[model samples]
Target: MTDTTTTAPAHGVTISEAAADKVHRLLVQEGRDDLRLRVAVQPGGCSGLIYQLYFDERVLDGDAVVEFPAADGATVEVVVDRMSVPYLDDSKIDFEDSIEKQGFTIDNPNAQGSCACGDSFS
Candidate 1:
């Protein structure tokens, strides 16, 4: 961990645990190794920018990787950068398994508003 980077506590964010577990399970099912869940912000959502999450294998310099214990007792890591921290820091990621919806949703405290389509954020 870097000076400015820290991991979330076990009783911290709610969504993070589920997201980490889902990511871990996905990697395992896909037969992947050494992959990290990369979350970032890029311009072009309904708002000014949208959240981006994906499995990444490459680790860049200055990247902040947050490690959390999964439900299965494995450590899951999410890598972000200095720039994307403010938008994603302290944010919770959860999986929606309802019949009407099934995907990862972000609960970001920094987000002011999101687009109608749910692709962009203010």
Candidate 2:
């Protein structure tokens, strides 16, 4: 189940509490303070654009950041450029374990279609 208690920012985008917890768990396991999940929009994917998910230790000079405050009040930041923010607005990052899929997934509201392998998106 997703965490539903956290308040959304004035902006339309919001992250579920469950997603925040999952990110926090990963951050704790990684044992890195400088690392955060960097979500970005790239030129190619199955669709016209793709979402990049990775680790970053440094915040660029003018990068936009979306931070999900952990249940314990610690914050796990999700950095995405301003351009990508609109496409990913109200999107949530979730963790799942199943026979077919096991990892963090982007629950993006703006993605109309995804690649066959689910690596890229439009």
User: Top TM-score: which candidate number?
Assistant: 1
Q: Which stretches of model 2 miss by more than 4 angstroms?
A: 1-13, 71-73
Error of 1 at 10 (Å): 14
Top-lDDT structure, candidate number: 1
Q: List the residue pairs that clash in candidate 1.
A: 15-93, 45-120, 46-120
RMSD to the true structure for each prediction, in A, is 3.3, 5.3
The true-versus-predicted C-alpha distance at residue 99 of model 1, in Å, is 1.0
lDDT of 2 by residue, 16-92 (tens): 67777777777888887778777777888667887787888877754666567776888777676667778888776
The digit string of per-residue lDDT tens for model 1 on 1-122 reads 43223544322333456777888889889988688778788988568998888989876876776676676777677777667877776778888778899899988887889988776787
Residue range with the least summed lDDT across 10 consecutive positions in model 1:
3-12
